[model samples]
Target chain A: MEWLQNFLPLTFDRAVVWIGVLCTIAIYSLLYRENPFYRFFEHMYIGLAAGYSLGPLGVDILYRYWIEPIWVQGYWAWAFVVPFGLYLYFIYSERYGWVSRLVIGLLIGASAGLFFQEFSSRYLVQLNSTLQRPLWFSASNPDLTVGNLIQNYIFLAILLTVMTYFTFSYQQKGTVKGIATAGRWFLMIGLGAIFGNTVMARMALLIGRAYYILSDWLLIRVGG
Target chain B: MQPQTIWQKMLAVDRRLLYVLLLVNIVMFLLVPVRMPASISPPVQKFYDTIEALQPGDLVMISSNWSASTLAENQPQLEAVIKHLMRKKARFSIISIEAQSRDISYRLAERVTKAEGYEYGRDWVHFGFVPNLTVAIKGMVTDLPNTIKQDVRGTRVSQIEMLKGVNSLRQYKLVIDVTPSGTVPIWISYSPKEVNIIYCPTSVMAAEAYTYLDSGQIKGMVTGAKGAQEYEQLLGIVGLASRFTNAISFSHVLIITFILLGNVAMFMNRLAERREA
Candidate 1:
């Protein structure tokens, strides 16, 4: 082991990088064919990620929020917080599963309350912006140029068509059916754009790993 | 009795071979000395301007919630944003909703700030990881010190010099959410109305955010590595994003080419089968 370390860049940082490179290779081996090496690394990666999160959970959350207050600040009531949270695990009990609903209900109530503010803050502004769009050239908002006006009209068309497609209350007529078809086409285009971006994002991840191997591990200077 | 048709052969090309070809293409682009400039998108331009408008000593909250899986995109965005904040002499703190991000962002910030002489407690801090951002943001909006309680190092939030007078989330001027997750809506919904938000999402998450950007809920955005590359250009510094941009651009080209070829092969194979019939 000592000789192995000596033969390679054996410093702690370098060693970690080497291990990471090996892990990367092991993980990528699955692309060729599923093998034990890939499976071992795959499990190891998941396990390591789970284990690593415990450090922050303990130090940042459990210790800072729970333990320190109880021990140093003499806040005895803080101790009950964890036990109360543990009631969620009561869901596993066949006999007392109803007890877990208390926690779930509390969470749902809190989330529902929070969602009111979320709805107003997140969607209202968008609604306002949509309504405030300058359909034609206006003196009040001089910056709303010709191009913006055209774009706004296009936006309105798409919004109306898409909304019509989702309107299930009435039987769509001939014109309505055409608009709904156009809406579906628009949605497909939007989805294709999303798929394109997704491909780019996935490629970036692969490129990142390759860059790590070539530049970090091999000490190859890539890109000026 | 006869040689295989070109379309049949093309259709039958091994997926492993395609993977190897893609790997080679990426490696070649990564190693190539050439650099392709990025056209600054509206979102990236807005993102740059939003940060550039920040005055010195103004507090900024960075919600770094990306793990190692997105290091390629998020790392460059964070690095560029941090450097920009430091250059402006802004007081900033990072909070991570993801546990892994807490350490990764902290270490990355430490490395970046150490070179720029930004002090830990006085100039910047890491609030560590919180289990939930919605709860944390709401709590911090009401009582920042009581909610976060302490920094990652166990130092009380009150003791941290940068947060000396900061009592609520309203005191912060900007919130930069660097994430591959959908936590931006929570920040927008729950955080104080005064604090403007900017987003840095992975490319896949960027499309959904356009509506938010259009509405001014988020002041700006940087979408993945390509966005980062544009941001680096605006900053006038060649960083990891700039380095990765060529490979990123070429990989898209490779994928698109393959898709077109596949379609052509399919069409030709169908035509040949019709002729045989």
Candidate 2:
């Protein structure tokens, strides 16, 4: 028990980590063989996560939509939640599934309404930004400044080529064909880069896990 | 016996040998543990400079969205950023979108901040975890206290010491996201223009963020372990990130070299095949 606080001078986070490391190994053990240990931890994790989320999520709903405005700000009546409560019971049977449509409809409508508005600003803006030539005004010959210009051009080429390769148009002819082929090659290169980086990231994660198994669990107990 | 045959021999070298070479390279670098000060990229420098410019009593929002598995990259970045914020006496609040991050980042921040005399509720608060970053951001933008009603300790946000004045997200000067995920765009879109967004994405996430860095959407970025190493140098502390980057940088050089040799071998093998035909 004294050892649980062993992370203080160095980390001060032993309690959760002690449990989490064992859980991680349990989860990963499925790769070798399925056992009661993995399921026990897995279910416990899911249950804990569900329980943990309920309070904050409940607060978000109550504080945002109901309590603050009605009680503190003095905006509306408490009776407004009556219909909302009815909306939750539509799962009783197939016949009443349409009862829940009111809730689903609003959600879908909001999502659909905001889709293009949000996409245009976030994604389209990013797309437009990526299209700029790195050469602020063309670097001195091919020798180039080799800085933002190189960075910008690489981003633009990667984005454009990756987009083109995903285009499913079958009009394969001339420059379109050439562009498509180039796009395919560029996409392959991009994927290769992602794969390489992914390997490094995964290796880093593995190293962290190993440190936990060796240094954290064995050498010293953790603290929270 | 022929030049073509020699090329074929080189081309047919066992891939496991390359793997062994890499393992040796990484192991050797790890043992030496050189904290080579990186040539700070513009984005990383900007990230450092942003923290350097913070004034006392300034409020910042930190979204800690990474777990322990990302400790090699995200943990160091967060530590460095938190150190800066605390050094400047900038009161900050942390929120996590991931469940583990809430515990991991919050506890880690609490640990780091305590040494700096950062009193909970006064100088630093943890808002716990929330799913749906987009919806949460919108809510926080609209009503900060209501959206994040409780501190990680379960105290109301309004009751929290430093957060009493923070009615909405507009009050914060900066939103520094120390994450492996690319959630900066959400903050960029929803938050008020007054709030500057800095990023701390893992190396894989950093390349994509260069576009944002170029566009100035994100103030700057700390890329992976290398960025953390550069940050550690700036902080004058030797941490895990500095240690890991030795392995990473040498690995990068190794990969680049392999790519070059692979191309050369491919060309030679093509010549050999043609000659045989």
Candidate 3:
């Protein structure tokens, strides 16, 4: 044990950093070729993440919310909560399959109720904002600048075209067909933009790992 | 002897070699001591102004729900925001809906707050990790203390000096959500209307947030590392985002170049085959 300690980084923090570097390399090695080293580390990483979450779940959620309330605070009503949640596992039972549906039904009902508030609060504000957009310049609205007016017009046009594209109630024809085609083009452009951003996001995650190796492990100072 | 053509070689280049090239490009740029300035976007400016509007001793809730996976992007945003809040003398509390983020954000906030001479329970506190964000936010809207119950240190929120008279979420002035997840919709739906919201989403998540930004539901946004770099410029500080920006920008250039090269190679190969035919 003493020899092992001496062989490793002296401080716990440094040891953790070393372990992180090793794990990063092990995982990235798969980019070259599939191998046992990469496989082992990949599984280990997933397991570690899942295991790490249990600590917080136990301390923060279970003990703090459920167990403590029942045992210490004498909230007897809370005692049934865990067992009731456990009924979800009855999904595998041949005879007791109906037991799981109770939990599923309760969850669906709760979600449905919550979604009512969610839809109203979430969409209504957006609808109000969209409708309230000033299409043309007005003297009463002093804040409406030329730039804002133009932007609002562009926004209104795009909104109308996009909404028209999604209208499947009637077959599109003539000018409506052209407008729907324009909306489809607009949607493709939006999707392309999203794809570009997704690429940027993935690149950032890669750069982050590379930065870690250079700065933290190699002790190199990066850009200011 | 048929010599290999440049187009043939380019088409058949090993993917591993490309990965190595990218790695080297990133490392080389990272080691350079130069800094590139970022232009401030309207969303970032609005985000800065919203925080600047906060008065001293005003309460703010920081919903930090990102983990190691997004540390590069989210950390700089969180650091810059916290520094600005501390500068404003605003008392704040952090809560994490993500289990892994609990410890990560706690340690990060501790490091940041400690440097600014901020006291724990007096100036700021961590409410720790909660399992469900939607339910928690809804509950906190009605009863803050009962919903959160206690701080990370096991101190009852009612006893915390900073939380005095903060009976509900309505008492808070701002909710800054730094996340890579889709939790902003939940906050908008459940949190108090009077309290404004600022978003810090990863780049992939930012495009979808524009509608919300247009709707005024989210007052402002900082999009990923690029956005963080812009925010740091606005604050006149050189933070992680600035350090990581060069590599990010250069990497994009490299990827785009390879994409163009690949297309050109494909066209050349097809032409050569036609000539042979």
Clashes of each: 0, 6, 0
Tens digits of per-residue lDDT for model 1 on A99-132? Answer: 8999999999998998889889988889999999
**RMSDs, each prediction?**
2.2, 6.5, 3.0
TM-score of chain B taken alone, every candidate: 0.98, 0.92, 0.96
Please give each candidate's TM-score: 0.97, 0.75, 0.94
Which is better, 2 or 3, measured by TM-score? 3
**Number of the top-ranking candidate, with DockQ as the measure:** 1
Tell me the spans in candidate 3 whose CA falls farther than 4 Å from its real position. Answer: A1-8, B1-5, B267-277
lDDT of 2 by residue, B137-197 (tens): 7788889887877777868788988987778888888999988887987787767777889
* Off by more than 4 A, model 1: A1-7, B1-3
Question: Which residue pairs collide in model 2, if any?
Answer: A7-A12, A13-A223, A14-A222, A14-A223, A14-A224, A134-A149
lDDT of 1 by residue, B218-238 (tens): 999999999999999999989
Question: Could you tell me the lDDT of residue A156 within candidate 3?
Answer: 83
- For model 3, how does the per-residue alpha-carbon lDDT over B144-174 read when each residue is reduced to its tens digit? 9999988998898999999988899999999
- Write the number of the candidate with greater TM-score, choosing between 1 and 2: 1
DockQ (CA atoms), all models: 0.84, 0.20, 0.74
User: Per-residue lDDT for B168 in model 3?
Assistant: 96
Per candidate, native contacts kept equal 0.86, 0.20, 0.80
lDDT of 2 by residue, A120-216 (tens): 6567767676544544655445545658567657666666666666777776678766777888898677677777777767656644454455456
Candidate 1 TM-score, true structure as reference: 0.97
Model 1: chain B TM-score vs. truth?
Answer: 0.98
